[model samples]
Target: MARRKIVRSPDLMLLRRALKHLLPGALLLAAAAALPRVPSLWRLVLELLPIYFSLVFVGGFLLAWQFDRSRIALTLLVLALADRALLHGGHNVHDVVALLLPVNLAAFSWLKERGLLTPRGAIKVGALLLQALGVAALARAHSPAAVSWLSHPLVTWPALAAVPLSQPALAAWLIAAGLAVARFVTRPAALESGLLWAGLTTLLALLAGKTEPLLTFYIATAGLILVVSLMETSRSMAFDDELTGLPGRRALNEELLKLGSRYAIAMVDIDHFKLFNDDHGHDVGDQLLRMVGARLLSVGGGGRAFRYGGEEFSVLFDGKTREEATPVLEKFRAELADTPFIVRGKRRPRKKPSLPLPAGSQKKVSVTVSIGVAEPDGSHGTPDRVVKAADAALYRAKRSGRNRLCT
Candidate 1:
């Protein structure tokens, strides 16, 4: 009996990552939101929770920034500080500044969408500094007239402070919500998902006429995003090949376990790889692997490629027969042969060059690959056996000639 070939769905992968980052934060916020229902606990903690939340946000932001230098963390930190300043010192100023919060968040989303604010860019830093300074100045300004002038339209128009459905604030929330949705649909990045949750929490807090819950939820959400980001980053390091940027053997093994029927497996090896490494040096060899990996990544015939240990690769074609996979594999092999790799001469001389010392050495090297394709046959009933069959075919191809395909 044939089993289906394994395939990883991109949408499902995105959903899994989002849930990994969001579920914990969602549960924490739910608990925090419910805490205020207990009158005694609410009164006891109300005065202290804001301070605690502020500290949590600040500390969490610092830790996350240290770990990953996240731009989102930094942005949230500045916003949280501004929020605290407005709450404590400037009641009237708070009204004015709160009106602007949504707009600032929307602008941040816009900048991120445009690629202007990246974790590595100075522009984000400059933007955050400007926002902090602007918010601080507005919140601390002692001029009641200026505060009233700025606040009157936002505070008095339609009298929605209790519901926080004012035009400016409402517009800001809408923008943030819209950005969050766009991110989930288009990118589904961890940071983007966190921002969406934070935005929702802020909106709910505004509607509930409470600050403590907002602060609590913000802190929990920020911390959760940081934790998830760190975990995901670590997992990638473990499962991804750093040199070639392909999923490693561990990922391949995982994929193999999920395979269904009628799939083809191809074992690919670079021709004379050890000789190339010994002659050209390890650096050139690494470049060759990267080049081959890039080609394999874009393999035709709906193939998924992986680095299957040292100097070896695997391509999985789910729901395809060997006949269907052969043309695709052959095309990949031909492409590798046609692409010439340029190797620059090293600055320092080495003992015993791998290739014959050049009489006017040509810097160009042509790379070729030997491939062995296998499908489910009576003898190869399991995934493991199928892989072994492909490996045996690979050896045959190498034995018969260096750059050819075997089945």
Candidate 2:
């Protein structure tokens, strides 16, 4: 038998994904870490960094808006507004705003985790309004001496022991770390990864104890996250089937190269698909294919389904024999036949003057599939050859009787 191709392991895949999202931020962090070493560069960067950050955040907001990512746009806007306030505000104003920053970030992360904020325009507008009110309140309000405990050495001791961060800042860092771990373990989405990297970069900047580098890293990380998100979206479009939401032929080809020894391949075709398409409208035919694809997606026996092409699907049973796969294929075929597909009736224009008008009544239709199973053996030495054998067996099934299986 042909040897399986060396493929990336799960840990390797996860690491690759993390690195892809973190690379840009990593570069920014490196640049920021080096800035304090040179006085002239540091001064120059400090003088111009605020302007650069302002433009970056503004441009990020516009891009997010254009992409209909309202939540992200609002986030960028909030960051921009806070940055501006900190740059121009007095000491008391800075302290109040700085205290609010972590609380806001943690709350936003919580809302995102629970899926409460869905990037809707109304939600974005409301959030922005609330942020504006909070900023206004902080601007006019004095720091309460009653809450002076917040800045006291006693209150700061515990946080300092853990990290050289304040309470609110520590809380925000913890929230970001938790979000990143959850995302990597549970879902591993691009946006989540980006947010995690951005958060880490923010924390790193804070640890460096430099104001200019902090702002610079913040803007750089935001821009990188946006770019990565767009790249991931485009990749999804290329790999996923638009109609059935299954992996397409290209995906199947890639998967085949990764299979190990002792696997079974099944070629499935809808029975009399062309005749069905001709009798019913093409739209109805498309619906039938969709239904079949959905059913194949849930196939058991350790099988993974792919939309091979029009009216055909391929199921691969990793580490299975023909005997192991046949029963599962039979079960799927039987279930498909038993389920009735209902098509709502519609009035059609009369083709001939003599023909009477048809009544609008719903019609029930059923579809059946013929599957052919083949396993790797001496005769079929390669995956492609095994697929061909399954295809030949599929033709045999069609010839024997439309809806039967052939091994």
The lDDT of model 2 is 0.66
Q: How does model 1 fare in lDDT? A: 0.68
Q: Could you say which candidate leads in TM-score?
A: 1
* Candidate 2 TM-score over all chains jointly: 0.51
lDDT of 2 at 321: 91
lDDT at residue 162 of model 2 (Cα atoms): 52
Steric overlap count per candidate: 7, 0
Q: How would you encode candidate 1's per-residue C-alpha lDDT over 1-407 as one tens digit per residue?
A: 65322221223334544575566547656765677788888777667765666566677666656655454565466566645654465555555555666665555444543232354456666766786677667655676776554434444544565554445657667767887678666754555555556566655555644364555544444444444544555576788777776789888888889988889999999999999999999987886777677778779899999999778999999899999999999998886777666564565243335666555563667788999999998999898999999999999999998689999
Candidate 1 global TM-score:
0.52
Q: Please, what's the RMSD in Å of model 1? A: 12.3
* Candidate 2 per-residue C-alpha lDDT over 265-301 given as tens digits, one digit per residue, 9 for 90 to 100: 9999999899988988787777677667767777888
